[model samples]
Target: MGDGRANNPNSHSNNSSSNKPEWLEQYDVIGKIGEGTYGLVFLAKVKSNRSKPIAIKKFKQSKDGDGVSPTAIREIMLLREISHENVVKLANVHINHADMSLYLAFDYAEHDLYEIIRHHRDKVNQAINPYTVKSLLWQLLNGLNYLHSNWIVHRDLKPSNILVMGDGEEQGVVKIADFGLARIYQAPLKPLSENGVVVTIWYRAPELLLGAKHYTSAVDMWAVGCIFAELLTLKPLFQGQEVKGTPNPFQLDQLDKIFKVLGHPTQEKWPMLVNLPHWQSDLQHIQGHKYETAGLHSVVHLSHKNPAYELLSQMLEYDPRKRLTAAQALEHDYFRMEPLPGCNALVPPQPGEKVVNYPTRPVDTSTDIVGTISLQPSQPVSSGNSVSGGNPGRNGWRNKSWQHSDAARCCTASSSTAADKKERIRNGDDWIPSTTEIEALLSFLI
Candidate 1:
């Protein structure tokens, strides 16, 4: 809690600043749970009923010191219209008339996929029980099915964004939080204009990496595939580095890593692949080397005969058109196999399976609720595992807060440019052999 981190979340104190808004007076501002570029999330309990906990997200004002943040407005507008058990519910929305700062409150989720996975991998040092895995994935897809059915695409689906309830009636229920990047696909996509980057690099779909000007809901399904792989193997399936820059930077390393496992995309498999902007313009760098899709089973340590593998293969299909929708995924044989998925993800579905007691999310009880938090980011971590003492994964998940991860950073830094490090890798605008490329190629082959 000393450095705005949640090392000890159980420590509690009612540390609200005197400047706290009048509306916030109804709830006891317990502490800060998370801080991201958009705002700070505080943990609070209703004064009338302390049993009911709430997550209060206070949006930061724009650099121009203007009115409410547009992202906040978008989240409010979309969430207010949709209602689902799997989706995070927006309980209240309040605005400060003086500063015009905005606040959105929702139910506090105790754990997220990122934290749960890390606990199993690091603390418990065991694979998550297959029954628990099935249950978690089932609920995730069930929730996603509801969203897709309603025509919404969660562009930024990842482990961290999928939150799980801690206790009380909704315990173990999965709630897909953070709707900032969510979009109703009933409207046509506006390409990079909407967000410099859509999905986070690691979980991003092939069509997106290939720079498809127009994409579909299939993108979210692709991320679901990535999350499923992580759940199965306890590590990311594709690890790619994002070149930090303004405008756009071709993600050569990520594609190479994906290709190494899934193989190169051929015209026969994905007929429309050739028409994508990056696939056309960056073909020379991409197609020059061919890859074979033979390592998935071995890497995941699952037999080709396994039902889980069959479902995973479908989800990770190279062609977005061929990928399984969340609805279709829910009907997969994997979920119907022995030890069928259960409603509660945290508990073992069957009697013999191990029950994992996950650590609860921490709250910073010392931070003043209305006090200023540092907006300047420290040097970014290469991946989310740095604090947890794990490897820097492929895709480089830099930030650790609720919405401060790599995908969301693209929104705030849309106008900012990376250092001129590209000069070192370019030979008069031509990409040539370098240590970075060699390492990326080595990673690809592995």
Candidate 2:
């Protein structure tokens, strides 16, 4: 059934019998916004209502000769049942009859948290306002709480999966987007670990890192803790590199980074830690080593130690049982602090500061609606999970850095001198010379 679709891209015309589904004909393709391992996301506007733009994700065919990808089916099934203001809304679904490709339409978001954070760090040259951070966190938790209460684990909750409305009724609202890795977690089912790996390497929970067979909502809390810390510092709290391979579950280096900051975990601290598969073998190397007693306060530099710090610490607790739930976190004193969390993440600049507006997501008009990046006879289009390898765009561990006393960058205040770039590297800033820098250096030599 999968191989039955027509090879020609132009076969899906309006008058043809093998044309687009009735549901799909309504949207006018704007351009390509993002490309994932399994699908291509398009920014489109509905013909009926041209006022609002929407994001249409077109899923590729199954690799195993199946009619449709199981991952796509799971995403469709779960998203159909779930609905929330803080969650990305699924507007409609359609299947291209010509190729049997599936498309899911969602409300459009102009900016994602990943882009937002990067804009502030590299472009704006300022940290995101605390007010904006609080609002984004509150909304994320609000949506996450809904998913947890419904017994669904999103599994993936990085900044890219978090979308913010551009304008209109939902303008400035943070919506939890992307549910490709999401699954309905119930009492009787296969262990989550059996269903391939979940969550990005950097935002992954400690239990998952230790090779826990079964986990709970606490895994999500651990990720939230990481995200919260990143929001504060504009950097990943535990920026660990992914260990790539087949059947290699233990990421020792990632765990090492965690231990370096939070210290070692003991059975007395987390009773379940001793029961994990990797705990025994992994513990051998770190048993004798002494670790600094660094807490959330050390990594996240805030003005004072208050309820916000307390909440951040509790959310990142090693013991899953001891971690704060999304619901509990909402009630924390951090939220109760003066100047309550607002509904919109776009906080106005204070007096004497100019307003900052971010650039919109870039769209490549060259890519057609069929989402065929390349259709060479020699190279077949592979149908794997849309998950990307290594860091992508301006997001992930490599893009952001640990600033302050930890890692200094001499390039910021200093001139664009070769000495400054060299000093930046010597000062512990792991910045590679960009393409522009290389071009400039070559021109100087000429």
Candidate 3:
């Protein structure tokens, strides 16, 4: 069970093996979309009245263990219980009898925030426009608020886990995905870590990194603060080196950056700081020393950065106790000041509703598409469409192969085949477009 694999061992073989499950036989597997530490993502189509497309994550059980990794199972279980526009929806989960593997289905998204930021570095650097930065931070705060409201702490809150759904007009509809390291808080005084390290190093809060036993939602707020800074700088706010004394080293440089930008922390201002787990030991060397702030007074200061200096300062506070909550952050001056234009806008359909076909089999139309789009458990639809001989429904479109000729593009709800190809390249997926392409696109769009 501890092995980094799925619950079913045989799923590692070719999907076309004769022993495949009957329900899975109908879906035509396209090329792989992504491969992770424990599973593979495939673009697939369902055979139904209205063929639909979907993304399926297939997990192969460890050869020496029972089933899928517990982490994957936990994500499925948690996501299945939560529903929000800002959170990725888990459509379905299937277990293959032949190999005992688990397959999780989800709505397909175009690009991840990490790729977008990395690609648009130049545009971000030339001038950290207030609108673009505010919009991104606003959406991020909105998503975090929704999650925290539900008591779900996304331990891993980083750019890579934040995905973008639409383009241009629909740019701000971000969805927070990947819940493998998430947890539900049942008590306010609960400890943070469950066992092994949870969050990624870069976005980890100081308390968590210092091994705090009892933590709260503030940990996530800190990560979001880090993300906010990254959005402005187009670079990680905390790029500590893995080893000390090298060109780079793991230290509290991010704290220094924050103080430099917002002014030094006074004991009276952040009284709890000295009590933090490693505060005394870690700061022993820097004690009494006048540290030169890194980004202080620079033209790239938060005063000119997106979201405003005051708002950013509250979020990046050294004292977790004084940090702004996600809900409070959403009400901060940055979002309230300009209020990201059209923040609630949805992605519009292309000129016309034209169906684009992928190599996979058509979708099943009798099934409920809307219901499947939610992570909540599916309610029985009385449409009389049985899995064996049913129509998939109006939204039935097989999840197209992520490797199709047009895999590099983005598609509106109504996009032509030609438009699909163009959309793919425009989304920066073509041959894994370089970072420059992203910068160029951002420059044009922003």
Candidate 4:
């Protein structure tokens, strides 16, 4: 945890890149997934389980001080103990001796919410199906509720951090990942860090960016509002121009952007705005002018942006005291009146229960495809293309042939080992279905 006082003037910024550590030789690299200021994520397979694929995040250790950033280490430790369907599961962490690097293993998701929005921007603009939007929002709120119930505050709540498991039908199984900036809020005692500039710029709550020393879960609620607006318009709601030198915002300029589209808040509606730590002093100067004409055009620039525009305005209110809580937001008229489809779908049945209402399958599994094994009622299957005919009741999930393509086989040949299999399976590589198989599975689930 940070000690409240800023670190030494010479401490390295978290954004700088460092040398790759040597201990990375244990696994064979497949490809790169994404890169950020602190680390690089690689698509890798454990040597023991040639069929399994995992995403490994390799972090650069400090040379003279603590090896891994304390914030990064704290996130890993916290996530390791949390097990939720909506939260990203942390598989394992290892310290590489070669260059003293820290590697974290996690489930590899197909794409994040950001990619989905970017890809479907046109579709969303034409007319977003209320059901689909409701489903996504419900999952996002559920994930946030789980985190808050566990006392975890996801300081950074942006689209990029919310990952989707399957395509379309299986779409709403959102997993909240990237806990490097998350922290547990303890009361009565002062927080370890006072630097409120934590979340991504656009999703940042007004209080934090203005240097509020103490905050609560409401900060995250504010971010959720930003995300909700983004989902509606297929564009970011509070994105402001980035300042060059200072990390903090000098004025509430982004709030002005939001008000321009939604209309200025009146004292009667937002009585608490004047009490905010960073309330604007020049409100009278722009009070009578049409906010939209004052260089504050909406990104979509739609003429009929009514209900969505109104709801987004309320969510992005500058006053944290007036912002909607997760539970309250869940009950808003937008979600209540026109709820998204599949928001109330039956939760997946527990082990041993029959899947009675299964959706239609695209491809018949009765006929086996090359390199793919036919699933049996019950059996213990190995990674090899071949399957063992074990007792029907031995292990319920055994009959499924763990498929491995030539690409996976080649990567596994070099690092095959029992330890590697255990590590890879624990990290979620074993659960990834082949792309062809995933399409078929989507047909059954969507």
Q: Candidate 4: where is the Cα deviation over 4 Å?
A: 1-28, 46-50, 122-128, 167-172, 188-193, 265-272, 280-314, 332-446
TM-score of decoy 2 = 0.77
Residue by residue across 1-446, what tens digits does model 2's lDDT show?
11222333333342356234345456677789999898789988888895579898989766656988878888988988998999999987765544556778888999998998889878887888777888888998999999999998888889889898875777779899888888888853577778887898888998888888788888888988998888888888898888988664678888888989888888898998878888877557655666777665877875446777888988989999999999999988898875578786775434553445878999988876744422222222443234444434557766566554545455444445777768878986787556868878888666
What number of backbone clashes does candidate 3 have, counting pairs of residues 3 or more apart or in separate chains? 42
lDDT, residue 373, model 2: 28
Worst 10 residues of 4 by lDDT: 368-377
Q: How well does model 3 score by local distance difference test?
A: 0.62
lDDT of 3 at 165: 62
For model 1, how many clashes?
A: 3
Relative to the unseen true structure, what is the Cα RMSD of model 4? 21.3
Better of 2 and 3 by lDDT: 2
Global lDDT of each candidate: 0.78, 0.78, 0.62, 0.60
What is the alpha-carbon lDDT of model 2 when measured against the actual structure? Answer: 0.78
TM-score of decoy 4: 0.61
Question: Mind giving the per-residue lDDT tens digits that candidate 1 earns over 1-446?
Answer: 01112211211112334344456667888899899878899998878785589998988866774656667777987898888888898888865444445678898899999998999898988888887788888888988899888888888999999998987888888899899888777864354335656777999888888877777788888898899889988898898998788665778888888999988889999999989888888757898887875688888888999999999989989899999999899988888778888778787645765667889778899986757533222333332223544345545555444464565677546534433435544535655546767877887666
